[model samples]
Target: MVNHKKRRDLTTRSVLIVNFNNDLPELEKALIPLNWECASACDLKQSLRIIEQKNISVAIVIIQAGNELQVLNVVSKLQHTTPDVKWLAITTQYPIPSPYLKKKLATLFIDYYHTPIDWGLFSNSLGHLWGMSKLQIESKKEVREPTLPQELVGCSEPITNLKKDLKKVAIVDNPLLISGETGTGKGLCAQLIHAQSAREKEPFVIVNCGALPSSLIHSELFGHEKGAYTGAERQYIGRIERANNGTLFLDEIGDLPLDLQVNLLNFLDDSSIERLGGNCPIKVNCRIIFASHIDLENAVAEGAFREDLFHRLNILRIHVPSLRDYREDIEMLAQKFLARFAQDDSNLRFTNSALQAMLQYDWPGNVRELKNRVLRAIVMAEQGKITERDLGLKLTNNNMPKATPNRLRTEIDTETLLEALKRNNHNVSAASRQLNISRTTFYRLVKKCNIQW
Candidate 1:
C-alpha cells in the first residue's frame, strides 16, 4: 500500500554527515544510490550551519573512541537546537569502550554503529527515520486548525460540553461568571466567549483584580478626571471605556475590594459608571465577564465578598475543568503546547515514557504547568527525544518500562539563550536556573556555542 509519489517525495529530503574523527570515503557514494541527497560537514559547527541552510531530515555523526566527550558536547547542543534531525552516531569502536560513553550515546543518538558498517541495515534505519520526521510535520498540520483557539483544541467530554455552553451563552448579553482552578485557561475561555459573541469586532479588555494595587483599583476600572488625586496628571480612560460595545473580562473577581464591589454591582445593575472626581454617570454598553479561581460562595460566607454582587455576576456560569479532572486531554494539550512553543521546523516527538509520566502525574498546576514543562524539556532533552526525566516527572510505579527516549524538539533562538545568560550575570548556573534547565546542560550549550560570558 505504499504510495510511490509519497516515497519519492520523502526521499528528496537531504541527509547530513558530520565527520568528527572517523573517515568513510564510500559512505556518500553508497547513500546516493539509495535515493538520499548527501551533504557533508567537517565539524559540529559546519554541520549545524548545513542543517540550518538545507532541508536535512537526518544527520550521521561519525566519531572515534577517544573523542566521545568533545563530540557529545557539540552533538547534544545540536540535538537541542535541531531536533528535527534524526541523528545516527557511527563509531569505530565495536564494543563502545566506556559504559558512561555508551549511556550518553544511547541517550543522544537514534542508532549507533561500528566500523565495517552494514550498509543495508543503516540505509533502512535512515529511511525510516526520514519517513517519521515527515509524518510528524504532517501530523502537526493535521491536528491544528487555523480558526480554533488553542484552549478549545480538545475533544474530551468536559471540553465538548464547555464548547456547547459557550455557544449557548455567546449571543446573550448578560454578565457571565467563570470559575476554575488557576492556570486552567479561564481567561482563554472568556476570550473565546468574546470572540464568538456579537461584539467580536469590538475591543476586549482584561483586568486582573488581584494584580492591580488597591489604591488604583477604582481609577483602573473607572475613568479618572485630571487632578482627581494628588498625582493625577491628566484625564485617563479606564478599561471599561476602552471595552465599550465589547466585552470586559475581570479576572480574579474575588480580589476586588469591598467598596469597589459596590461600584461594580451598581455598574452591573445600570450599565453605567461614574468617573472618579466627576458627578455624571457615563452609560457604557459593554458585556461583563468575570472569572475567579476562589469560590465566590465561600468568599460570600466569609464576609469577604458581597453576596449581592455574587448573584449579579453569577447570572451565567462556566466552570473550566482542571487538568487532573479530565486526564484524557493531556496528550492533546501537550502536543498543542509543543507546536506553539517550537521556535523552528524541527521534528520533535514525545517518547512513550514521557507520555506515560505525563499521564501519571497529578498536574497540580493544570494546563499552565504542562505547558511550562514541555517548554523546559525542549531545552533540556538529550538527543532529539523528550523523556520523563527531561520533563522532571518521576514515574509513580516501577512497572513502567523505560523506553529509549526521543529527542526533545524545539529551536530556541540564540538571542533568547544570550538574554537568559545576560539576565543571570553570565553565571551558567544562574542562567540555567532562569531558563529552568540544569546547569550541566546549559553549560554544555554555552561551551558549544563559544558564547563569551
Candidate 2:
C-alpha cells in the first residue's frame, strides 16, 4: 500500500485512470472546469494509492478484454473499491468478447466510450460528474450533526407547542418516536426535528418501512453484497449509509416486518448493520427518528410488533393533532391551500356562504384532502366564486353522527350544499357553481334536489 496521506489536503478534480500507458497528453486537451490530475498505471492498487493521496472524486478506467475472467475481475474491484467514485470506461475495441460485460459496465460506470472517444461528450460527462459531486457535498453539509432552527409551521396551540417539543428533542441524538392520527402532519413534524437537530447539516433520509417488501426490506435498509441474493445485480449502500452523519427517518415504523424489527432494534442501540451477505458491519452515525399513524404501544400489546423495539424508539415522542381537533384552524389551513392552488392560475374566489360552509365541514382526510379539494374546485368551478353548493355538502337534515360539534357545525355536508343551493335558487348550475363543485356534479345535485334547472 502506497502512502499518499500527505497529499489528501489538495482539493482538485483528481482522475485515477487505470491504463497500460501514461496517456497524460491525450487527457490534457479535454476541458472539465476543475483542476485535473491523472494516473495511467494499469495497477488498480497503485491507482487506489494515488486516489487516496489525491482525494480523487472521479476515476476514468481504460481497459480491454484480453481474457474474459480478467475483465470481469477488474470491473468488479472497480465497482466495489470506488463505490461512491464516478467511473468512465474507455474501451479500445468494439464487441468485446461478451456484450454482457459492456451492458454491465454501462450500468455500473458513469459513462462508456468506444475507441476514439468524443472529447465533447467526455467533457460533458465530466461536467455532469462535477455537478453531482457539488450537490452531494452541499447536501451532506446541511445534514451532518446539524442544529437547525424550528421548521414546523402553524400558530395554533398544538403547532406552537409541537415546535417547542421538537426543539428540545433536536438537541438529543437518540431515537424519537412520533405517534399521530393519519393526515396529522407527522411527516412535517419529523422534518422539523431533522431541521432543528444537531444532524441538520448532514441530510434527512426518510424510509417508508411499510412500503418495503419482506424479501427486499432487509437489503433496502441494510444493503447487500453483489451476489448476496438472486437479483443482487449490483452492490448498493442503503439509505442508512447515505445519511451517515445525518437523520434517518423511518416512517410508519410500526409496519416494519418482525424480523426487520429485530435488525432495526439492534441497529438503533449499536449504530451498526451488516450488509445482507457481508460479515463486516458498516458503522452509521445517524439519528433515528420514526413516525407512525398507528399507536405503537397498542401494536406492542397485540404482539404484532416487538416490545423491545418500541421501547427503544420511544425515547422522544410528539403527537400530531387531527384536523378536527384544531377546527378553528380549518378555515385558515383551507384558505392557505386555496391560495396555493389558485396562485396566478385561476380566478376562483370563496363566497362568504362557501367559507362559512367550509368552516362547518368535517375534513376526515385532513390537510392533504383539503388541498386536493381546493385545487379540484378551482379547476372545475366555472363561476368566479365558490358557494355552499360548490362545496358539495347539503345543509339541511343533520342526520350524520357529530364528532364534537363545538368545533364543527352539526349538519351534514350534503345538507349544507342543499341549503346553499335552495337559497341561491333552483338553478342547478348556479347552486353547484356557488358550491365550487363541477358542473356534472351540480347536475347530479339538481336531480337529487328534484329541482328543474
Candidate 3:
C-alpha cells in the first residue's frame, strides 16, 4: 500500500480501470493511497463511454488467466479511439500464457505487473507516465499554436473571409470539399477544420489519392486481406477503417481514378466499407474532408470525374484564396516566413525594393511559392537584409498598381492594423513585427486610429 500521507499532499488525478476479472473493488482500494479518482468499466463499450466523458490520462487493465485475447481486443479498440492515454496492465498469471499474447501485450502497454503487487514501483511508474503525458500535450500546443485559423498569418479581406468560412464549416459534421489552386494551403485548411471540430481529439488521417498508382490505389485506400492477392501475408486494415471515429482527409481527390471514385462514393453514401477479400461490411464513423487543386466541375463536364461524387462532397465547400486575391498580405507573409526560416538572425528583414517587387509581381504559385522564395532568399541574402535580386524577382515599371492618395492609404493602414492586432491576439509587439514596423510606431498608429486593445 502507498503512504496515506501522500494522498493529501498531491492533487487528485483520474485513472480508468479496465476491469475484466471482477477485481474492481480490490484495485480501487489499492489506488486510494495514491489519491487517484477511479472510473471502472467492465467491457469495451463502457470503457469507451467513460474515456469520452472524462479526461482520462491513464488506464489500468486487469487481465485474467484465460482472457488474454478478450483483454487484447478491448485494449486495441480503446487505443484506436484515444491514443494519447498511457496504459498499464495487471494480470494474475506470471509470464502470461502464450508467447504471442505476451509479445502483443508488451507492444501495447507502457508497463505491466504480476500478482502480489509492488505498490512502490507501480506508484513511481504511474507518476512518471502522468508527467510525460503532460509534456507531450504542451509540446503539441507550441507547434500547433501558430497554424490555428486565427493565427494563420494573414489579415486581408479574402483571408478574413476564408477564416469565417472555416469556422462555419468546422462546427458541422459534413463532408467538406476544399477547392483551391495547388499550394494554396487546401490541405492545411482541411487540418484546421478537423482540429476545430468535435472530432478534434480523434485521429486525422491523410490519403494522397494522386500519389499512389492507379492499380494500387483501390487496395491502399480500402486495404487488402492476407493471402487475398500475390503479396498477401497478413490481414491489413485499410485507411478508412483506421480512421474510424475520426477525420479522413483525401488530398488531391481529383486525381483518384474514375473506377475508384464510384467505390469512394459508395463508402460516403453508407459509411461502411468492404475489404478487398473480406465479405462482411465494416462500419466506419469518420468525417470525410476532400481537397482538390484542379477544377472538379470542369473535370465532371470533361468526363474525367463523376458528377454524382462531386455533388456528394460539394455539400459543404470552402475555397482557399490565391496570393493575388489578397495581395495586401504579401509583406506580412514574407516577413513571417523569413522569421521562421532565419532563426539565427532575428534582425533579418526584406529591403524596400524587395517588398515593392513582391507587390508588383503576380504570384502564379500562390502562398507556397511565396514561402519557398523567402526561404531561398534567407539562404542568399547579405548583411541581414533581403533584396529583390535575392528573391529572384525583377520589378517592371508597368506591373505596379497605381498608388493611392493619403486618405485612401490612411483607411487601408487602419484596417490592416486592426486585423493584425486581432490575428496576433492583441500583442502589440507581435503585431508590429508582423507589419514590419517598430513597437513605438505601432502604438502611435493605434492611438491615432483610436483603436483600443
Candidate 4:
C-alpha cells in the first residue's frame, strides 16, 4: 500500500502512480504541487492497497514491454479497485509486438506519452482525465456508469458531447436515426441510446433489414396468424409486437423493400400493426431506433427509402463521428479494448510507440479496425508490450503517421489544467483546496505558467 503523508502533505491535488519500471526523476517531474506529489506502488497488491487508502485520483504507468501480463493484471485491478481513478500510460513510442500486451492495455488505460514525454500534451490529457473524474464525483446524480458509448472512448471534448447527446436522446420516446459510416458502431449507438431510454427495461429486438429475405419481411416484422401462408405452423409474434414497450432496433434500414417500408411507416405513424393473414390490429407501445450506413437522402433521391419514414426517424438523429475525426481518443480507446479481452489478461501492456502508430492511422473502419488490430495483437503477440508490429500496422514509406502530425498531437497539460480550473471555476483557492496546498503555492505555479488570474 502507498504510505499516506499528513492531510496537509498530500492534498486534493495528490496523484498516485503505478510504475513497475523505476524512474524517480521522470515520475517526480510529472508531479505538480510537491505536497500533492505522486505515490508509488511497489507491487500489484501494494498498488491496490495504496489506491484504496489514498483515494488516488490518477495513475501513471511506465510499463515494461516484457512483463505485459503483470501490467495487465495491475491495470485490471486498478479499474475495479479504484473505479474512479484516472489512468495514464507513459511509455516508449509504439511498434510494441505482443498480443497479450495489446488487448489488455487497450481495455481501460487512457492517453499516452511517447519517449521524451511531450510535456505540453501529456499534461493536458491527464488534466482532461482528471476533470472527468471530478465531474464523476460532483455530478454523481447525472453520471451513469460509462458503457462504451458508440465505441468512442476518452474525455476529449467531442466524445464528451457525443456522450451527452446519447444520454439526452435516451430519455425521449422519439424515433432515433443513427447515421455513421459502416463499422462505425451505428448498431451499438442505437443500443446505447436505447439502454439509456425509458424503454430500456423492455425487450430490445434487433432486425437486420438488409438480411431479412423479401418473402419473410412482413411476417418477421408484424408476425403472422396461424396457417397464414404455406409454411405457417402457428401464430408468431413479430419484431414490432415483441418489442412492446421496449426498443426495436432496425439495422441497415435502407435495404428494407419499398412495400415493407410502407408497413414500417404505418407502424411508426400509428403504433398499430396487423399480422399477415390476421384481422386484428395489434397496438404496440414502443420506440423505434434505426441505423443506416448509407445516406438516406441519396437513397430517397433514388426512390429507395421512403421520404416520410426518413423524416419520422430523423426526429432524434445522432451522427457518430468517425474515430479519425476525433483522433484524441485513438490510444485511449485502443487501450480500453486491449485491457478488456487480452489473452495474457494480467501481464500484457502496449508500448508507447505502438500507441503512436495507432494514433497516426486514418481509421477507415473506425473503432472496428482498431478493435481488430488490438484483437490480432492479443492472439498473435509474443512480447510483453504490443506494438505496431503486433497490430500489423506499417507506417507510410515517407515514415509518417498516415495523417498530419497536428491531429495526432494531444495537448496534455493545458487540457488537464483547464479541466481543473473549470471544475473549480478558475479559482486558485478552490483548486488549491482540493490539492491540500496553500493558495499562495497555487498562485506561484499559475504565475509560472502565465495562466490568467
Whose lDDT is greatest here?
A: 3
Model 2: lDDT of residue 403: 73
Candidate 4 residues 343-420, lDDT tens each? 346588888778777777666557876876686576545657787887877645454345535323223223434555
List per-prediction Cα lDDT, in the order shown: 0.77, 0.66, 0.78, 0.70
* Ranking 1 against 4 by TM-score, winner: 1
True-structure RMSD, every candidate:
18.3, 21.7, 22.6, 23.1
Off by over 4 Å in 3: 1-151, 399-453
TM-score of 2: 0.55
**lDDT by residue for model 3 (1-453), tens:** 234534532466778889876763667887778777888998876886566455567899988767888888778757755667899988888867888778977899999888888777887787788778768854653233344243467999999999899999999889999988656888678888988899998888888776555777788789888887888788888888878888898887877888999999999999999989988888999999998876889789989799999999999889898787789999999988886667766888899989999998766557877986786676557788899998988977776655556565456557768876776655555565455344544665566577765
Clashing pairs in 3: none
What does candidate 2's lDDT look like per residue over 1-453, in tens digits? Answer: 112432432344556776655443576556334356554546655655454444456777666656434544554555544345677777766765577776767676777777676777786787688668657744643343243343444678877787788889888987888887555778777887777777767878877776554677788788888999887889988878877998898877876878888888889878898898899988999988898866678778979789888878777788887776676677777677676556544567878766666666676546655665665555445558766675564454443336755224323334545664565544443444344333443443344445432
Model 3 lDDT on a 0 to 1 scale: 0.78
- The best-first sequence of candidates by lDDT reads 3, 1, 4, 2
The positional error of residue 243 in candidate 3, measured at the CA in angstroms, is: 1.3
Query: Which residue pairs overlap in candidate 1's backbone?
Result: 84-347, 384-406, 384-407, 384-408, 385-406, 385-407, 385-408
